[model samples]
Target: MVDYIDQHRERFGVEPICRILRRAGIQIAPSSYYAAKTRPPSPRAVADQQRLEMIRRVHVDNYGVYGVRKMHAELNRRGHRIARCTVHRLMRGDGLRGVS
Candidate 1:
């Protein structure tokens, strides 16, 4: 429901959408719309957990010699869509440093 409202919000402005939903007895607040847009991850948080797991596995699989940067590159090479910072966090937490 929120997703539908958000997707069509541009086409039929915020107030109007709110009005329509309210008329249909959905009872969504204006603040709710704003909150949904600004709130942090739900699905993304779960995905990041999975991604970090993969990163940790990759790090250990490589004999714990790969640092965040290298791990990020390898993850990308292996077609995992993830951010470098996430890789950094995972590596840092595991204390896996690169051999420079």
Candidate 2:
């Protein structure tokens, strides 16, 4: 709704839009929206991006046949020290699937 508020604030107004959103259970303070728009990504987000890139490279290098278990093993074998669940989570988020 931040994008919608930004585009239509001149017509509908910011507080009015936020009020409407709140009624729909999508609560947001204008200050929060503006702050989120200006702030840089958090450290966790940066780490997730880095890990996702590495995961994609592993997936591609292994011919995309390995599932979460093998994917975690391969990443560990390469000295990554990442968790199996994290690999599975990233794979699912990216729409990746094993050949099984």
Candidate 1 worst ten-residue window by lDDT? 87-96
TM-score of every model versus the real structure: 0.50, 0.82
Q: What is every candidate's alpha-carbon RMSD to the true fold?
A: 11.7, 2.6
lDDT of 2 by residue, 1-100 (tens): 6788899899988888888889999989888778877999999889889999998999999899988999899889999988888888899999888997
lDDT of 1 by residue, 12-88 (tens): 98889889899999988888988988988799678867887887788779987887788888999999977888777
**Clashing residue pairs found in predicted model 2:** none
Give candidate 1 regions above 4 Å deviation: 1-41
- Model 2 stretches with alpha carbons more than 4 Å out: 1-14
- Residue 46, model 2: lDDT of 93
Evaluate model 1: give its lDDT.
0.82
Cα lDDT of model 2 overall? Answer: 0.88
